[model samples]
Target chain A: MYKVKVYITLRESVLDPQGAAVQQSLHSLTYNEVSDVRVGKYVELTIKDTDRDLDQLVKEMCEKLLANTVIEAYRYDVEEVITQ
Target chain B: MYKVKVYITLRESVLDPQGAAVQQSLHSLTYNEVSDVRVGKYVELTIKDTDRDLDQLVKEMCEKLLANTVIEAYRYDVEEVITQ
Candidate 1:
């Protein structure tokens, strides 16, 4: 099996209102040292071993379903899992 | 400055309905090799230099605002940023 960890975040040019709200909340809570905040999605997928190229498959999955490529960008790390 | 990357995931014992929905969607999209899926939150914080211990400060922030500790578990990675 393989474990894939994917991170999807807004493009650098995009405005992240959710992040801004979180920063504001932190400020209200007196965490004044925080200068900025960006929020994103983290997904973990467990896939059974397959003959298909893993990296290619992951990229296809991200583009087609995991990420909204218009306003968001995604990256992933894949690792093999050892099962007893 | 310090850049902190935080990942908040549901505790292993908790039911993740959002993750289940995502898995179902992926299956419908024909990614049948995927055996399981888990979704979580990824937050990036840009914090101005502080005299406080960075790790402890981040831990406090996670407990106080970033994560709901009752059902979620969080981990963070911190790196120093150099400004020219």
Candidate 2:
């Protein structure tokens, strides 16, 4: 099996209200030194095969459905997992 | 600085169309053994301070804004980074 890790984040110039809210909460909780907080998403997937061609497949998936390249950016890493 | 990693995934019962599409792509790419694909999100945040109270602050941040606890589930790990 293969494990894929995907990270999605808002475009750098875009304002992240959710992240701002978290920043505010951190300050209120006495973590006043915290100056910024940007929140994003992490997803993990397990696929049943591990072939040389799998990389292209995963990349196509990321482009078509796994990510919205306009508003967000995504990166993924695939690794083979050993089974007992 | 402290680095926070957040993972968000669809609840077990929710159908993940995006993930399904990716799975199909994998099969078409000759990864016929691949049976399932679920997509989620990953976010990373760098906080400016690391005090004993930081744990509580980060948890609150995750609960209120970093994650949608109802439709999604999240877990985070806090680590201190050394500056060169």
Model 1 misplaced stretches (Cα beyond 4 Å): none
DockQ of 2: 0.45
User: What is the C-alpha lDDT profile of model 2 across A19-72, one tens digit per residue?
Assistant: 888778767766676677777766566878645577776676667665678887
Please report the candidate that would top lDDT against the real structure.
Answer: 1
Those runs of model 2 whose alpha carbons end farther than 4 Å from true positions after fitting are: A24-33, A50-52, B10-34, B68-73, B79-84
RMSD of each: 0.7, 3.9
lDDT of 1 by residue, B1-84 (tens): 999999999999999999898889888988889988999999999999998888888999999999999999999999999999
> What is the lDDT of every predicted structure here?
0.94, 0.72
Across B1-84, the per-residue lDDT of candidate 2 in tens digits comes to 777776778888888898788777766766666666767766666877654577776677667765677877766777887887
| Model 1 pairs whose backbones collide | none
Count the clashes in each prediction. 0, 5
In model 2, the clashing pairs are A41-B41, A41-B42, A41-B43, A42-B41, A42-B42
How close is candidate 2 at the interface, in terms of C-alpha RMSD after superposing the true interface residues? Answer: 3.0
**Candidates' TM-scores?**
0.98, 0.66
